[model samples]
Target: MTRILCIGEAMVELSAQGDLWRAGIAGDTLNTAWYLRRLLGPSHHVGYLTRVGRGDFSRRAVDFMAAEGIDTSHVTTDPTREIGLYAITLTEGERSFTYWRDTSAARGLADGPDRLQSALVGCDIAYLSGITLAILPDAGRAALLDALRGRDVVFDPNLRPRLWPDAGRMRAAITEAAGLAALVLPSFDDEAAHFGDADPKATIARYRAAGAGQVVVKNGGGPVAYGGPEGSGVVDDLPRDRPVDSTAAGDSFNAAYLAARLEGGTCADAIRAGHALSRRVIAHPGALVRAAV
Candidate 1:
């Protein structure tokens, strides 16, 4: 089985209801891991790598992963800190987050190089995001990059510029990370806004110049552009249909695309898989729609 390691944070998500909130597990990498495991079914082994506290919430998160068929063996226990928490509100089907994660235990995921190296033992693919890079301290980030040196890394510059100290630092880090990645998936909208790229072609060119071997640029309502040696495009034409929630759209797309491509499907098939899964996710609420999986 192909073993994939999703490295990042998973937080307790509270979605606003009429007077109360619904609690669940959600995060960029975690969402991808969940959808990846679901799509792959029994063929691939998916593991989440992060640190969590000994609190009940942390325990619940771990149990959630196990229930979702994800491996929790690399989840480290940090006695002093608990998992992060976030609240979400949907405004016209778009979601906004209020994070209470300053002391999130996952910030220490790369605390020890040796431990990270050990955990990578059986991993065939390593996946992470720009948010993962933002959460870590310099030392932790350095440790993570070191451990990822020779791995088949898949990265998404899920850009949230506000999280970084500055745009320059974020670019430097992202460029370095892209260089280490075998595949770099970036949203064209975010790329244009953050990097001043004029088009998806520019986004592809930028990442390739930064040393990424494969690049896929997703455009919300435009043609999805991808390039390695050749180029291809796919546009999402499915009806928006008054989305209940647009959360984790990119996350789900990433999962389906990766899962299909890993299973030897063609790029066109992978893109369609991504588009179909993303459409399904947006029609529901929250970052994850676990039921009917």
Candidate 2:
């Protein structure tokens, strides 16, 4: 089996549903792993690596991953801290979040080099995000990057400014992480706002220049720009009505694109597949939607 490991946090998610609140388990890397598990056949072994508390929420998160066929053997338990929680508020299909993760156990996920090396033992593809870096301590981030060096790493610069102490450090850390990734998937809006990328092409250029083997820039419902050694091109995203909740659109797209590419599809084919899955994800509420492509 081809082992694919996603390294990051899984939070207790709370999404506002009218008067009531809906609770579930989700996070950026976990979201991609979920969709990847659903898209890929049984031959692909998907595993999650992170630290969680011994609390009920943390136990539920691990149970949820197991229920979804994701291997949870690398999930470590910490007695001092519990899992993080975030609540989503939606306005006209746009989503914003308020997080309670200051003391999250995932902050120590990359604390040890031995654990990081063990989790990557036979990992064919290892996935991570800027949020993962932001949540980690300096030494932990360094350890993670060192362990991931020379590996087939896929990175999403899912910039969350609030998670970082300052903008300069965030940018530097993301660029450093991008250099370690074989493929860099970045959303145009986030790159534009934080990195001053003029367009999707600029976003692709920046990551490519940062030593990313390939770069794909996601532009909401707009055209996607991609470039790499294999090839480069633009693929127009399918036009659709306003979404129900835009949470995890880019995450789902990453999963679909990577899954297709792993199955030997071309870059253009992968982009189209990504778009198809992303459109379906935004058509529903929450991050882990029931999507097929």
Candidate 3:
């Protein structure tokens, strides 16, 4: 079986539903893992690596993964800390978040090098994101990067400026992390805002120069630019409807794109697959949509 391990934080998510609030479990890497679990069949094993607390929310997060057929064996528990929480506010299909994660247990996910190494053992692909590094301490990021060395790494520079101490540190860390990935997926808008990339090609060029084997630049509901060993080209995104919530568009796209690539599809074909799934995901209300793509 092909084992894929996604390393990052999963938190309790609250979204406004009419006059009340709806709660669920979701995060960037976890959302990708969830979509990957659904997209890939039984032969592919999807695992999660993170630290949560003993609280009810934490327990629910673990149980959610188990219920979705994702491997939760690498999920470590913290006795003193609890899971992080975020609330979503959507305005005309666009969403924004308010986070409460300063003392999140996931900040220490890479504290033990031995545990990190052990968690990665036998895994075929290790998937992480910019948020993963942002939440981690400098030493933790170093340890995690060290453990991920030489693995088939899939990275997403899911840039969040507030998460990092400064722009320079975020760029340096993202560039360093991208150098370790076999595939680097970045959103063009984020790259333009943070890295001052002129366009999607510029984003792809930057990552390729950072030693990444392949790079896919995602443009929100527009054309996708991708390049690597398999091929290089632009694939137009699937025709999309008015989105009810665009929360997990990129996350689901990454999952589907990677799933297609892992199943031997070409970069262009994979980009199409990613866009198709992402189009379906944005029509739903939450990050983890319960419908099939």
Candidate 4:
């Protein structure tokens, strides 16, 4: 059995809906881990590596992950910090999020990568997001990158500009992350904003130069481009017919692609699986839609 470790924050999310609200847990890596568990079932083990507060919300999140068959053994509980919270506002099928996550316990998880590194040794694949690196202090980031040296790592540059102090630091961190990743999954808009890439091919070239064996550039509502040992090219004519909400499109796509690749699907087949899953994800209201696993 193969294990996939997802390292990042998991925050409580509240979404407004017709004078009422719905609550769930959501974060980039967490969302991917959840969807991966749903897609792979018991055959592939999924683990979430992050710290949470010793609070009710945190407890609920742990229970939820357990129910979803995600391994929570690496999830640490911190007494001092409180779990982070975010609110989602949906209007006409478009969603925007406001976060209050400055004190998230995940910030501290990065500080102690030595303990995590030992636990991660048995994992077949490790997945992380740019937001995971952005929340860490300089020392924590260094420790994390060092810990991931020889693993089949998947990097998603789920870039949130507001998380970084400046653009220069963001670019530097992303560049470093790209070099460490065996597979790089980046959104076209994020790559362009941070690295000044003009198109998907340019973005793939940028990551390939950084030593990534595989590069997948996710362009919203447009064709997705990919490059790997099997060769590189674009899979065109994939415009979302009616993209309901672009919330977890990229996250779900990453999960589906990785899952398919792990199942021995070709890069093109993996991208098609990614497109199919993302199309279903966006048709719902929240980040983790309550659908059949």
Candidate 5:
């Protein structure tokens, strides 16, 4: 079995269901971990690394992960810090976020002993996102990077500019993280804002130079580009006529792509899997849809 260690924040998510509001747990890495475990089933061991508070919501999040068959043994608990939350408003199938995560427990994940280290060392892959980088303090970030040095890291620069302190700091952190990752999955819009790339080719070049062996740049409504051991090429063009919500498109893409690769699917096959999953996700309301797996 391939063990995957996913590190990030899992927060209470409040989304609207018609006139009523529904509460659930959601985060970038958490969402990926859920889908990855679902896709891989019992063959892959998926463990999540984060911090949660001693509250009902935190407990509920753990219960949710357990129900999904994601291992939460490595999740640290803090009594002081509370669980974070974000509200989502959907309009015409499009979603926008409003956060209340100033003192999220996940921010303090690296403060304790090397417990997380043992879990990570046992994993075949370590996956995280840019939001994971933003929430951590300098010391925590340093500790995380150090621990991840010898692992097969999968990074999705799921850039949330509002979560970052500044553009320069975000770039520096992303550059450092990209260098450590074996595979980098970056969205074109985020890359354009961070690196000022004129197009996907330029963005792929920038990330490739940073030492990523596999680079997959997803362009919204445009062709996806890849530069890897199998050689560089455009994976596929997006559907022109489909209406998309576009919230979890990239996250679902990352999951399907990684799952395909881990299942021994070719690069082109993986990209197709990514696109197929993403198209379905964006056609729905939130990050996940109620379709048959």
Candidate 6:
């Protein structure tokens, strides 16, 4: 079986519900892992790599991952630190977050990376995001990137500037990570806001120059620009439904796109799959919605 390793944290999500809250496990990479497992079914093995603590939230997080059919064999066990937590606040179909993740166990994943290295031994593809780099300690980040040297990487620079020490550091890290990736996914608004790219095409050119072989630029409610060694063009006929919550739009899109690509679909087909899933995801709440969503 082809094993795809998703490297990052899986936090305890607390989503608002008027006078109450809905609890779940969610994170950028975790959302992708969940959707990929669902889309790929039994043909591929989807593994999630993270470190969690010995608390109840951690235990529930593990059980939640298992329930989603994600491989947890390589997940690390850290006793000192507990799982991170984040709460969601929705407003007119968009979402905002309030995080309390100082002691997140996943920050220690690459502190002593023997197990992290061992887990990648037979992996076919590895996926991670900018958030993963921003959250790690310097040594851990360096170790993680060094270990990813020769794999086929799929990276998303889900830029959250506040997560990094500074813009320059985040830029340097994202540039290096993009160079390591076989395919790079960047959202247009985020790129424009961070890199001052004039448009989606500029975003593509930027990553291509950074050494990524293929680049995809996602424009919210607009055409998606794709450029790769095979060929490139715009996919504009994507779904345009009004989103109920835009929490995991990009993450879900990434999963569907990768699932289609892995199964030998064309870029256009992958984009369609991505857009379709993303549309469904936003019509619901939270990062990982129901299968019907």
If ranked by lDDT, best first, what sequence of candidates would result?
3, 2, 6, 1, 4, 5
* Residues 1-293, model 3: lDDT tens digits: 99999999999999999999999999999999999999998999999999999999999999999999989999999999999999999999999999999999999999999999999989999999999999999999999999998899999999999999999999999999999999999999999999999999999888999999899999888889988776788887457577889998999999999999889998888889998899889888999987845
Best lDDT among the predictions, by candidate number: 3
Task: Give the least accurate 10-residue stretch of model 4, judged by summed lDDT.
Answer: 237-246
Candidate achieving higher TM-score, 5 or 6? 6
Error of 3 at 240 (Å): 3.6
The C-alpha local distance difference test score for the whole of candidate 1 amounts to 0.89
- The local lDDT score (0 to 100) that residue 9 gets in candidate 2 is 95
TM-score of each: 0.96, 0.98, 0.98, 0.97, 0.95, 0.98
Give the Cα-based TM-score of candidate 5 against the true structure.
0.95
**True-structure lDDT of candidate 5:** 0.84
Cα lDDT tens digits, model 5, 5-53, are 8999999888777788888888989888877887886788999999999
Error of 1 at 212 (Å): 0.4
Worst 10 residues of 3 by lDDT: 234-243
What's model 3's lDDT at 265? 92
Instruction: List where candidate 3 sits over 4 angstroms from the true fold.
Output: none
Report how far off residue 50 is in candidate 6 (Å).
Answer: 0.6
lDDT for residue 64 in candidate 1, whole number 0-100: 97
Model 1 ranges off by over 4 Å: 230-242
Query: In lDDT terms, how accurate is model 2?
Result: 0.93
Candidates in order: C-alpha RMSD to true structure = 1.5, 1.0, 0.9, 1.3, 1.5, 1.0
Model 2 TM-score? 0.98
Off by over 4 Å in 2: 291-293
